[model samples]
Structures are given as structure tokens and as C-alpha cells.
Target: MLSLTRLNRVRSMDAVNDTMIVEAGDTLLQAREQARAEGRVFPLQIGSQGSCQIGGNPSTNAGGTTVVRYGNMRDLVLGVEVVLPDGDVWDGLRALRKDNTGYDLKHLFIGGEGTLGIVTAAVLKLFPKPRSVTTAFLGFRSPDSALAFFTLLRQRVGQDVAAFELISSTALDLVLAHLATARSPLSLRAPWYVLVELASSRTPEDLENDFHEVMQEGLEDGSILDAAVAAAEAHAMAFWRIREEISDAQTRAGGSVRCDISVPLSKIPAFIEEACASVLKIAPDSRMVIYGHVGDGNVHFNPLRPVFESAADYLQRTSTAITTSVDAIAMAMNGSISAEHGVGVAKRDELLHVKSRVELEMAWRLKQAFDPKNLMNPGKFLPRLECVEALKS
Candidate 1:
């Protein structure tokens, strides 16, 4: 791990081509800063940017809030240099925007979660940083209204919409109770809220005006119950802090059984409604902390233990059932059980249960081809398929 960390370096920066060559060990924050220095941007913004390494970002195909605009780590990476399990280095770091040479090998390891090999460095794609920005906290009667507001905002603003995050009232209460700096920006509280941002290379006045016009229409149409637009950069940061501090706030409440899942944007409200009902039926005392990137259909459905119940007892009784119920809803909606989080040991069995036989066989073959000896990050992403064969025998 020490050797891997030592690989941090910005090998090259071509501002003309809007590309940067950075080692995998460099923190995501480091990569963003380097791009900013060149008057460009690497727009993978996540709460863990300060400590999470670039290599791991691509390995997990991390999708942050900015994914609504800039896309995930997999889409941002142009090329990568990887070390095979047998210590052979495959240096395929090319910065060209159009390279259809062969099988697009870099993708094999992007979301592979280090199972195939070790990613040492990468050629990252960059974009022109947005000069003007505006953020707003909008209150909605429910997730369905929130989704409607999201669609309306996108239709009006188009690609300028940077982040569209959904926050439940439960999530907001947690932030206010636990986080000292947190405060409710809106005067009237609704059951749901959306933290939205608009950005462009144009002037701030233009962006602000456009945001105000759209919001006013939403208010008139009853899609928006109330709204608080950031008057300054500090105010925007405050609104964002509410979204960013959710995990910490949940931790402060008590440990939670969290499920990172995604479904069609249209099915979000139905999935939440059904899943919440299912969970309460199994554990009536469980508190559901629902939130996530609503624009992209990924939600973090977390069920916290009741204050009166012992943590060990609650988990032992309800953890598996709650997660299974939530995931089953997502799968039924043609969504994913593991969205951006990736399938580590925690979800290995869940993946096996969800994936088709052909998909599992293909994954097993890829594992065998890349790490034949089973030495690279073994028993993590892919489960032992031989067990299924043995059972049949």
C-alpha cells in the first residue's frame, strides 16, 4: 500500500488538448487543483475527494454529485497504465480523444475494483470550468413532486444543471440535530427537498436570472412549495454542506443499514413508497433515512435502528431482511442493487443472487483471464462460481 501511495505525481498537463496525466495515487483533490491551475477542470466532485485516491475513483467508477453534468470517473478517464498480476506493466496512456484501436482495454479495470490489476496512472479528460454558478434549495410536497421539478428544471436549463440532489425531511432533521453549522435555509419545511446547481461559462447575472425565472414558474405551478436561492458563494456552500454531511449525521444518530441502489427516474417514487412500506412491515420501529442523486436515479435508502433498541439486536434481527427488501424493489424496477458503490465483499452474494447465469459466467471468465492465479484482490468482486457447479453435481 505504501508503494502504491508513493506513485502520486502529475506526469504531464497539456492545456491545449484539455488533458492531464496523473498517477493513480494522487488524491482526487490534487487532480482537480492541477486542472484548475491550467484554467480547466476535472469535475469529479465528491465528499471524499480530499482523501480518496484517483486510482480508486476509477477502480470504483465513482459517480459524485457533478455526475449529472460531468459524468463518472469511467467517462472522465481517457487512458490508463496498469500493472498485471505478474508484475508486467501495460502502459497504454494515450491522450487522444478518438482512439478505436481495439477492445478498449482501459474499461476492463475502470469499474473492476482492482480485481483485474493495479492501475498506476491515467490520462484524464478535462473540461472548461464553469465561470458562473448558482445554487438553490427547493422544497417539495413529496419525492414525486421533486422528480417533476427536476424534469422541469432540466428542460428549462438543459446542460447547465450541474447537480440535482434529493433530500428527505428525515435527512434534513438529522443534519440539524447533529451538525452544529447546519441550518434550514427555507422558512417552510416540506417532506422533500432538492439541492440544485446551475453552472456555465457565461456571466453570473445571466445564470441567476435564468434560475429565478424557472423557479418562479415552478412556484406558480405548485411544483415548488418553497425555495431558498443562494445569494452568495458562502450561502451556496452552506446548502451543499447539508447534502454532504448526511452520512456523518446518520452516523451520529446511530449506525444504519445502507443500500446504494438505482432505478429509472420515473420509478423512484414508487420504489421508495413500496420499499419503505416493506421495511416498516418487517421492522416497524426502523427509521428510514432516504436520499441521493435523483437526477440519475441512484438513491441511498438507509434504515436506522430505533433509539430504544440495542444496535446488535436490531441489526441481527432486521439488517438482512431490510436490505433484501429494498434491493428486491430496485431489481423489480429494472434497476441495480449496487449502483456506484461497486460490489465488494459486502455485496458479493447479493450480486450473485441478482445477476443472470450468463453474466456471472462472463465475469468469472474475465477474472480467470486477468488474474489466473487468483492473486490480485481475490474473493472481492466476483464470488466463487464453482460452488454453483458443485451444488448441481
Candidate 2:
């Protein structure tokens, strides 16, 4: 395996241009810390930031909770240096914000998942560091309530609203039971919860008053059951910990059928309700550990096996059924079955089921043009010819 782990380096930092050129092997945390050292923020904040390499971020086009405001790896990247198949180096390491050149070829490799070429280094856009930041946790009786508050929030604060994450009570139950320190931020027991954060470098003053006004109105108008503004940085981190530990708690509680999906914002509430029903119709006892960046409509609708169920039986009989059911519902809503996670080997075959024949043709042609020798990371991301042929025909 070709491992570029040793290539970890921050090649250059252009504070004036608000861009940083980082090596492929540099961890996301490394990039962020370097940017922070310059008093700028590299906003791709994922749970795996400590280890997830910057190259893979663009290869898969990773999106985290911050996607609501700053966008995904694709949006943050300006240009990339790729090692092409024929031993050619495509030196596209430019830091131009508005390079209206030919076809904008940098995008070809951004979400290509390493199938096109190896991204050695990239010019990543940076943002002005937030002068003021506020974090709050709110509870809702239903998904609708949470969604409505998100709308109200955006209207009130605009781009200042950085993150609006939705967590289900079932997901929280897993966290509280698994993590010894985990505790609910709000006293009220609500089925749905949101961990919202606001930050702005432009705002000279603290954002508390502006944030509270919106929260107060949501509570008064019956949009939110309970809301708590984090009293300190520690409190804010504690609230964030609950949202971040979901996958871990689910794993500790015995793994789940992971369905990463994204629908339009307006359809999130109905999509969740319908997806839950679809999953229950098959595995009635599966615990729905549902949560996501609902502001962007990316739902991690994972269903855990029942406590008493055997893992073997569940894997053999229940797993595919659960995944298929939920995935089908997501596609029905005109949403993607794969959101933050790209179409790796896990979802390679599933790509045929979702992608059209024309789209598949374009991808195949591009793959052939880039790596005719089948030299790069192959046997992943897309299906074989025999598989796509049936769909194409």
C-alpha cells in the first residue's frame, strides 16, 4: 500500500490570501491548529480531525457539523496537486479565489475518492476567526419543532448560526448509558434535541443578547420545550461531547445499520418519521439512534440491534434488510443515500441502485481517461462493468 503518512507537512501559510497549502498526510487537526496560529480558522471540524488526513477529506469530500455555515471539504479547497496515473504531476497548487480558467479541473479530484488520482497537497481556504462565539442546547417535543426553530434561527442570525445539530432521545439514551460523564444539557425530557452554536468575527460585541432573543421567542411561541445557553466554555464543550459521542455509544451498545443520507431541508421531519416507520416495519425492536446536521438535512439514521438479539442472527438476517429499507426511503425523498461518507467498497454496489446510467457512463469514462492502466487505488468507489451494464441497459 502506498502510504503518504510521512508527507505530513504544512507547506505554506498565506495569511494575506486567507489560504493554507497543506500536505496530503497532514491531519485535519494539524491544518486547523496551523491556521489558528495565524489567527484564522480552517473550518472543517470533523470528529476524526485528530487523525483524518487532509487529502482524504477532499478525496471523499468530507462534511462535518460545521457544513451548515462553512460547507464541506470541496467548498473549502481552492486547488490541489495530484499525482496522475502516468507518472505525471498535475501542479494545480494555486491559491486563487476567482480563477475562472478552463474547466476548473480541481473539482474532478475533490470528491473523486482517490479513484481519479492521489491528492498530494491542497490549497485550503481559511476564514476570519470568530471574535465571539456562543453555544446553546435546546429540547423539542418533535422533529418539526426542532426544524421550525432552525428556520427561525437562520432568519434571526443569518450566517452567524454556525451549527444546528439534531439528536434524538434514543441516541441520547445510548450516550448516557454508555458514557459515564454524559448528561442531558436540558432538564426537560424531550424526544428531540438540538445543539446550536453561533460565531462571527464581524460582530464586535458578544452574541449572547442576539442569540437569547431568538431562543426566548422560540420558547414563548411553543417551538422549543426548553433551552439552555452554556454558562461557560466547559459547559459548551460538555454539550458538544454528547453530540460527538453518538457513534461511539452506538458501537458500545452493539453496532448499528448505518444509513448516511441527506434530503432537502424542508423534507427532513417527514423523512425521519417515514424512515423510522420503514425501519420498524422490518426490525421492529431496532433502536433508532438518529441524529445529524439537520440544518443541512444530512441524517445518520442508524438502527441498532435489540439488546437481546444475537449479533450473528442480526448480521445475517436483519442488517441488509434494515439498510435497504432506510436507504430506499432516503432515495424516495430525492435525497442521497450516502452523505458525508463517499461510495467506498461498502456502498460501491449500492451506487448502481441509486445512480443513473448516464451518470455512471460519465464516471466510467473519466476513470478510463485518467487511469487506463488501472494503476491508482482501484476495486472501490464504483461497480464493475458487468454490474453497471445491467443498470446502463
Candidate 1 displacement at residue 195 in angstroms: 0.4
For every candidate in turn, the CA RMSD to the true structure comes to 1.4, 1.2
Give the Å shift of residue 153 in candidate 2.
0.7
Candidate 1 residues 1-393, lDDT tens each? 335777899999999999999998899999999999999989999889999998898899999898888888888999999999988999989998898878999999999999999889999999998989999999998898888878887887799999999999988988999998789999998989999999898899888888899889889988899999999889999999999999988877775889999999999999999999999999998887899998889899998888899778888999989989899999999999988899999999777678877788888888889889998888898878785344344
TM-score of each: 0.97, 0.98
Clashes of each: 0, 0
Stretches off by above 4 angstroms in model 2 are: 202-206
Please list all clashing residue pairs in model 2, or write none if there are none: none
- Please give the distance, in angstroms, between residue 281's alpha carbon in candidate 1 and its true position after superposition: 0.7
User: What is the lDDT, from 0 to 100, of the residue 243 in candidate 2?
Assistant: 94
Give the lDDT of residue 43 in candidate 1: 91
